[model samples]
Target: MTFHDREEELSALTTAFETPDHEFYVVYGRRRVGKTELLKEFCRGYPHIYFLAAQEAEERQREKFVEHVADYFGDRVPRIDGWDDAFEYLGEKVVDEDVVIAIDEFPYLVAENDSLPSYLQSFVDEQVRGTESMLILCGSSISTMESEVLGHESPLYGRRTGQLDVQPFSFREAREVIQYDTEDAIRSYAVTGGTPMYLTLFDYTETLAENVQSKILSPTSVLYNEPEFLLRTELRNPARYMSILESIALGHTTPNEISGATGIDSGPLSKYLRKLQQLRLIDREVPVTASAKKSKRSKYSVADAFLRFWFRYVEPNRSSIEEASKIVYENTIGPDLPNHVAATFEDVCQEAIWNGIRHGMFDQYSEVGRWWYGEHEIDVVGLSPTDDRILFTECKWTAEPVGIGLVEKLRAKTKHVRWGPESREERFALFSKSGFSDGLEQEVDDSWTFVDLEDLEQMLSAGR
Candidate 1:
């Protein structure tokens, strides 16, 4: 509903606006990811004119632009008929003072007028090259924006000075917006992935069930149709995209698995994957060290939590899901969600370790991530980027105490992973939701840092 984050983006835009010369900047993101809001907020106080390109023909668009420029110019606003004239008039208005003129949904304009970018670029080269104004081209269609505006061969290529690929709000910022330690907060996060527009539906005071029933399950509510809206905006064939996304959500990560599950061939599926990846709705990742740029090792997953939730529960049971009542949906989501949450919890732990090393919480380490060799996979890997020192950790989300045998197994697994012969200084670490076994705890006098969930909470709380 309101801007709760993006201080950094706003600051960057502010600096750009205050800069000299004819500044051409582009801001793009997936649809409904708040690209327009960021631009609007950044352009609020300045002498600015905002024009959104629509799906109209070039002539109609030109007329609308003329009307908008006319409005800004008041009685003296020129009766310009073409985009070139409109931009020229805009250049005239801000000849002396620097101004921000934003054309939101710029791709639509380009679609309507294929030569729009070329025309603007030509206008800038001829009349506005030396002017003191900023032209922002903002769009939600990521692929089209990149190809049409920022591509190397694009007509507008090498013209724009800055570009912002606006992303969904991070988990930390989302937490700030809804500061609750309850399950509802986690569920809301898992459902929305910090998209401000979607997260606003979550009432901080209400239970997760209440929020879901009121906002998501209700036929008249905004969330009930949210998936369709997003899917429609991002893809041409919503059914195919929905199938691919649901397969990934259901744990079919590999191309073959997704294809098998969705009954789509891998050849056609790759295109969908690319589109989804470009939209930032899903991620295609390797095992952190997989060599091939695109191979079978690459696994696909829904990158946004909200999209993941939709695919996992809502999309799969669209035909008969609501008939089962809110209680059934809640229970179904409840059981499998903690496992997903656990994976994110491990990610948080990895970040904590990195943050710790940055703030002197640990003496040494370089890299950290999921590490594996053959079938043995370790959750945390801390390798000294500066030195040969390496640390391996197994993060667990259980109440049971991690015993010495688990450490021994991890040590054995490490043997397969290469760390050079001189990597004798390697140490082992464990992060647990519960705590360590007493025998293992006594053994780890100073050789390791046995961190429990409470300890991590304390460390995070101290902001060290």
Candidate 2:
């Protein structure tokens, strides 16, 4: 719940405030990504009027907004009839002192009134252009916010002095809040991703199983119903969307595969996948060695880690959990949780590798992602712009230390990866749950990096 890691966003807002003229900032992201929290944090040391808009009549929202304006300016609540009068009154208040007027859920206002952004464009140009006061438009609806506020055709597009896309916290930032031990913490991140709101729901003192049993599996808990509720709230066809997500989480990645699994036609399935992609609920991935636009091997996966966890464990076994909650955890999810977490370990290692690049531990990477050609698959591939360095990693979430044989097998996969020239230096990284054996340690060289669970933790900690 406490604010951590948004210094970059905070700094951007602060810099905007320090600029000489009036500033209009478009701040946006998906719901529960902490846009509101970041905005509130930036407004902490300044005189500001924070107005949260809602789904209501334009008159109701205007009335509420004017009241917020009135409270900030120490004036009586006026019976404002229109946005023109509201802007005029607000303009008068911002003339002498700098006061930020942040409209949270700005898209909601546009939803109620289509011409609201046009009205804002005129207001900023005529009313607040030369004033020191700032205006921030924040929204949870990513598509609505971008198209309405930041799109080229939008009236308010060129008017914005700055924009901030508030993203979910990184795994490192998530770890700061989710203070479990290393293994459990990774499991927790696999469940929650990096969303601030979701991270707060976890209690570090409790074991992973305890949290899953109580926070997610229990019928009354928020997480138990989260993915279903979120889809219903965000998408018009919730049942169909749920089916598609469950299919992807279950390992049906391609369009035809998903269609066969869900019985949805590929034509309509594409639209659903596009919508989910736009909402950041699903991500489309091509191999690291291939161009995404032209690749026929593109695969779609659930982007939100928690949604993946929900669809995989909760959605499938809902009936079993309803029948017996305690038995369900021990019998169903508990046994398979390790495998679930292991699936996510490759991503965690890639994150650490990127962090390593930032801190000079790893060579520079122009692109880092999974690469697969036919039956050959490389877990993590980091390509360099320099053409001199290419890194391939194999992640093993096993109980025992990785031996030289496994490393050599990973080395064998590198020959199939066709990116740089054959002479290009290919480096290998092995990430393991337990560690590397003494025999494998002898094989470590300039081209090889061994990352155990603790070493991975420390690598992530570098940025934290």
Candidate 3:
């Protein structure tokens, strides 16, 4: 697949190349998030040596690195006895010329030899600094990368000149990559969750149900066991993490609820939750109007849309998938997928609103998130604490036009949100899949901004 969006990352690398000195960059993200692809794109025209570290013994990895360095120099070099000798050779060869040496999956090397970071630190301080060489260390293990490479106590703590935590694409970028109509694109993104590899696995030419059945629900599909594979690779005990994730997926959002459902003590569950949050697999959220940061009413939810969908549908119906039965897709997933997509659509709308704010299309806000009070909830709320202004927004994914009722309800809920003083300025924004009703169109004024699917598409395209 063609590279879609990484302009910022590429620009960063381009700036790094202009320094005319040594550059040490650390790039890390989860698997299949395009870390290697980003590095390869940056290294295209440069004289670079790219080495992918494998899960092998230290001796074997060092030998492989020796071969890569020899190939880059196009000469017979002496065998490397260890990492020190390897880095020394690289530093000597690239001293006079601008060259890049990127080691992908650096964690694999560290797994084999725990002192690889120390060796790298020593080499960078002793030989590579003040030279015209660039070194990029990339990895996929988020926990390991944080604790081993970028941690405060690590030997290579302050050696990196630049670092990037490459994340999955945003909703707008995902739409561009998928090339589907707004509604279908939203549905596809709900399952793919902005992951480039997952988006590429889907075929836009096919219907959503057909694609889901073939590319996701089927036993032979690449994404069938994708979440499982990721969790297993990242966690020492995958089963416990699975239980916690499943609990969250099933709507047990609080620590007490999750612990009750998973039969794990809150103490141990908190540790697991922290690890999951660190991995970007789950997120903790409090009410947007909460006074305290650590509110007791905080909730936990799966951070990745794809993982949420998989845990909600696929993992629970694994027996049907293993039996190769179509009923699971038709009866279980097909019936409820629209509701799932609708929920994800709210997220997409919020993202689009934020993008608009970034592009100067909307007024700046101090805080933006969902707001809830008692039984009433508002989908999107952008509050300006200093300016005493609040934007109350609602997102609808239905085919029927959103009438004035939603706007009225949103106004009613706004009264409950105690953000600023009583004289706070208020605005209303409504986003709908279908166009708004005639009554709503007539109600549009300076304070009300109605956005239909077409309007959203324009906003997304303009922001891009």
The TM-scores, one per candidate, come to 0.89, 0.96, 0.97
Kindly list the per-residue Cα lDDT of model 2 for residues 86-151, writing each as its tens digit: 888888788887888899988789888898888888889988898988999998877888788999
Error of 2 at 407 (Å): 1.4
Candidate 1 residue-wise lDDT, 311-362, digit = tens:
7777766656557647656677667767766665676577668767776777
Q: How many residue pairs clash in each candidate?
A: 4, 0, 0
Error of 3 at 40 (Å): 0.9
The better-scoring model by lDDT among 1 and 3 is 3
TM-score of 3: 0.97
What is the number of residue pairs that collide in model 3?
Answer: 0
lDDT of 3 by residue, 206-310 (tens): 987888889988888999999988997698879999989998987898899999999999899989999999999998987787855667777898988899899
Which portions of model 3 miss their true places by more than 4 Å?
443-445
lDDT of each: 0.75, 0.87, 0.86
Ranking by TM-score: 3, 2, 1
TM-score of model number 2: 0.96
